[model samples]
Target: MKIKDIVNRDVVNLENCEDEAIHIPGLIQPHGFLISIDADKEIINVCSENISQFLDYRYNEILGKRIDDILGKDFKETLREFKSNSLEKKTVFLTYNDQSYALTIHKSQENIIFEAEPNKVPLNEEGNLFESSKRLLSSIEDTNSLKELSQSVATAIKNITGYDRVMIYKFDHEYNGEVYAEVREEHLEPFLGLHYPHTDIPPQARALYIKNLLRIIGNIDYVPAKLYTYVESKVDTLDLSLSVLRSVSPIHVEYLKNMGVGATLTVSLIHKGKLWGLVACHHYSTKFLSQETRNAVKLYGYFITSQIDVRILNEQYEVAKKANEYVDKLSSKSLEFKRDSLTSLFQDDAIYQLCNGSGFSACIDGKVYSNGETPTEEDIRLISEVLFDIQSDGKVITSTFPRQNKGLGSVAEKFPGINFHMLDDTNYLMWFREPTIKNIKWAGDPSKAIEKDKKGLSPRKSFETFTENVKDTSKPWLQPEIDACNKFKFFFQSFLRAILTNEDKEKQRILTENLKAVNSELENIGWISAHDLQEPLRKIRMMASTMLEDQQRFQVTEVAEKRISRMSKSAERMQTLIKDILEYNRASSEEDNFEKVDLNDLLQEIKKELKETLEEEKAELVIEGYLPEVSGLQFLIKQCLLNPIHNAIKFKHPDRRLRIRIFDDQNHSKSDMYSVISIQDNGIGFDNQHNEKIFKIFSRLHSKSDYEGTGIGLAFCKKIMLKHRGFIDAQGQPNEGATIRLYFPKVS
Candidate 1:
């Protein structure tokens, strides 16, 4: 019958078979009888319809009865012990009517299921299980190569099960199956090395294989026995996931019949919780294995699964070793050079052999470099864009056939395989492989494996060998090759970071030297300009003074005399500006003229120099406390002190006594870093907001008519303090008083 008729009605074609509820089939193979007891109540609730064939009572009569009523008190006690211990599953041998059966009990949902099948294998065969398994495991351990391990397993299982053919089938990344190793009877055609598409075993079947671990079909043509449940018990569908006598799918049976297989046994090999492959045994005629024999085979499968990871790693050890050597060489070379390291390394043969590629190409700093054989520039650019679209975390993107990507189909023939590694957005390295022709042998025509007729979809009715010439596809990239590329990408990125860091340091050093040279030239120009302007100012002052003296000789009027007086004053102010400009320049350029100066002695000199102005303004210069010695240029320190004291006397309020205090700030002297000296006066103080602005050259708060001096006085003070690595601060409010404090750095 078509699968749609016997299986779930939703399964009309192979595409929909993945959704089939094979785990809850509600039927058992006719060779065994199943009984489910309510775990909490200790009562029988479900049984196979064929149970009457083995026992005296029918399934209907057995259902809804207590376990002790059917199997006696001793059996119920055993069941209770099994439940209390919480064992996964237990198998016990039971004899009734002079017939022996293996009774397997396991928990399913809220029920405890008991599946019994006839034990027909000889006791001697079951007795040798442990020793035989030990020998098989030893053989596998001694075999270093993966192929040798597969062949040894196939040969050993065939000898144990007495099957016509035993094959070690392996699945690729895409779940496609390949007959990796095989041992068969001489009369049978060899099915070794034949490939099968993943569709042959849908996702649901693979999932069941992982869950159940092992399955055996005693007679492929045998009828399925339906399960019978008590109506009042309300068990809708029985879970046959852990049932050893679970009925096989009709579609699977039909597929096997087409291959002329009478019975089959499949053992799942699991690694890291995933279904790795299977040990498939096929018999040309009907066969059945006792529970003891099946358990022995399962133990062998477990041994193989446990060793799969280690064996695979052992196989790739040599490849990884060589890749490490290449990485070390490339990284060392990259470090030896400061620039063009990537460009130079890209030309080396080591990069091409790093991943065992036929060709290599690199895009660095907008330049493309190539070695060995590579695709055209245009094709390379297109491939790079595609790789960029899928780039992630410096992962190596590998493709066995470039044609698989729609954008790369046209260039696939030029380079069928590629390993693309993107270092960044605009730079990458790619390795390529040329097209290789392979003659692949499939068990059947994979393209037509699943056929549709008027009834529904069906398996192909052919097992004869089908060979096809597969072209434009290179040998697949191995995991070690991909791993090597990833390692190289990491080294390349690290090298670039190191190079960029060193380059930035070198650039900073060059810029610092250039800045120093530019400052020296500007200082020289300012000094020359200030010295040259002094001569012109002296000539102008002389001319105005002579005109003032000769006013009566020229009969000069009152306006004329005033004009001469104004010209003389203008020239005098110009002379003061040039003098202050020269002082500012000297402060910045004279760095080696530092000396220890006594501030008390310097203040006495300043008071003597300003004696005439002090007497005229009627100001009091009070030295509040003893001053400390500090290190600075002597003349610049004099100007630093002279400017502020003069301004304090000049800007004093007219209504108040011009009392000026000259003292060392005791609070500032307590600190070891700096000494502070303050000049305070009751003057027409400026706003506090102009504290910073007033220090700039030529910055004046009052007009020239009110304040008769160059605006460079405070600016000169700031520059001198800066030359001594010191600081100056101004604090005041309008019409109150102003205090200018100078902080001189302490000499160590």
Candidate 2:
């Protein structure tokens, strides 16, 4: 047939090769013959065209024959016995025309397939298969590293199969193949350390390798024998996934031929039910292994696969042991320092080495802290925004090629790799890796891995070494390293939660104390309503009754007028008490309305509201140094300053004029973090021992007749300061002056 005709007939082009139905190719290699029979009727349904070469019958004669009539009742009984059990495949040797053949039987969808090949090796070799596997496993178990294990496997397989060359090919995360270890003849060129693009083995091919543990091509140049179905049968295509003699893809055959390989064998190394790598053998000339030898090799591959997980975990344990030490150190340091642990941890070089990172950055409580090498603050912010948008449920995110992500491409040259974890909405941690230039050696130019020619699509023909330089990528993060990062995240989050819990406990304690104080104040209020408030009401009623009776007897007199004047004063005092109580209630229940509040502006407003009172008291209010801006409720802050200023005028010393000064506190050192403003008054002051008690609700040091006040003003100011997450302090000296200071936390 013409090459073009053959290409069109069977070759799957690269464009659609991923969807190729290689499992049901309906052809078998010429070295072996295949026959399939219906499971229910035991009648032949499909048979390879080359079956006549072994069965002493033409294709037509064997097409519709019963299993018992074609291969005798003994073979039928064997098939029944094999079917009764749960084995995947069963092999039995039978003598036909003075030649012994090994027939492998397996079940397809609803049919049973039998593949037969000539038995060239002695039965004695099959008896020693267990011993051979034992020695191979021993050699593999003694290896200390993955590379050593792979090299040992390659050498063992090469010595057993007598192939010209043997290689252990491992796949990367992208499914690209790398010749990890190799054993070759003395004169042959080396293929070790060469990389192959993922396109070399399409997804479909890799899937087949996972299903079938072992596959061999006896001769790559041999013709394929087409499968012939019975005239009365409905089966058009036969599934040969388990067929030992299944024909290889035309593309795969061409690939082998291009490399001058006449025969090849591949044994899958499966770990954790997934294909980890492969043991690939190549022969310079047409070669074939007996069924016994192939079975021995398959058993050896199984033992090697069993050891993979154990060895890998053993290696990772060492790394994890060291990582645990770093975690312990970090925990100790975080506990030892009461400040920001994220900042303190980064200050030590050990944190950078913990993850083998070139740079580190952390966002703790909306503050950014970084160490080692890092991008600009603006760039870090941009990256953080992208990360937060994609973050979900605090899962750790990692990438080797950060440039592939949107908005990060520009900064990827400096920060090529990143490992990130979010603690909360506003807090996160990140580790960065700098780009390290890498020189890679490929089996061929990967850029030309696939090409379209007259044959539709073909793999590259050259096997010469090709060099390429890779950039903008750091060394890929190993699984152990990533696990360590996860451990660190857990530890750090626990530390943060502990800190928050302690703060919460302290706040709760304060709240409990305030609740008790409030209960005491409510009791005092009840007493005032019963005695202090009712006293005025009693006097007004008594005075009115006396006037009414006296008016009935005679005209109004001076004594009656005196009683009326006292009633008027009593009514005024009752009205003031009710208003103060209402104001105190509003202060307790009002929600915070926080914004930038200029203290200077607030004091000016207070001055205007109390203008009449200041004038009546002849109070000299002086403004000292400028007051700074703070975050607080404007209206509430105005009230906070108004009450103190009003008190200075109300309680002035009878011997002298009252003087009040408002200014920012110059004594506090942490001005950057807090805004402390003080109000000092030169008026009648109480003993210093009553500094805290004066702010208590209804706590009066002097008689009510002397001060004419309800004592609720200072308490209201204290509540406002508490709502702003700040505090108010009072200091006083009898017959001297009093100073009250408000400490407000500066907004970030």
lDDT of each residue in 1-748, candidate 2, tens digit only? 1010001244554455666677887778988888889988988888788888898876667777897788887788888898889567888998778888889999998899999999888556654665656766788768877778788877777767889999988888788899999999999999999999988888978888987878999888999988887546777677778778988888788888889999999988887777778889999899898887887677766756777777788888887777667766876772532345556676776665677788778878777788889888888888888777766676545555465574567676677778888887878888888888889899899988877687677778997899999777887676777777778888878877777777788789999999979976985675566456666676776666667568756566778667676776667677667767766766766777678988877778777877887888888888787888888778778888888887877767889989999988867775666788888998787778888998899888889787778888889889888988888888887778788888899767
Candidate 2 residue spans exceeding 4 A from truth: 1-15, 122-135, 334-337, 340-342, 501-748
Report the C-alpha lDDT of model 1 over 513-579, residue by residue, as the tens digit: 9987998888788778888888988898887777778887778899988987888889898888888
Each prediction's TM-score against the native?
Answer: 0.87, 0.70
Instruction: For model 1, state the Cα shift of residue 623 in Å.
Output: 6.8
Q: Give the TM-score of candidate 1.
A: 0.87
Highest TM-score model number: 1
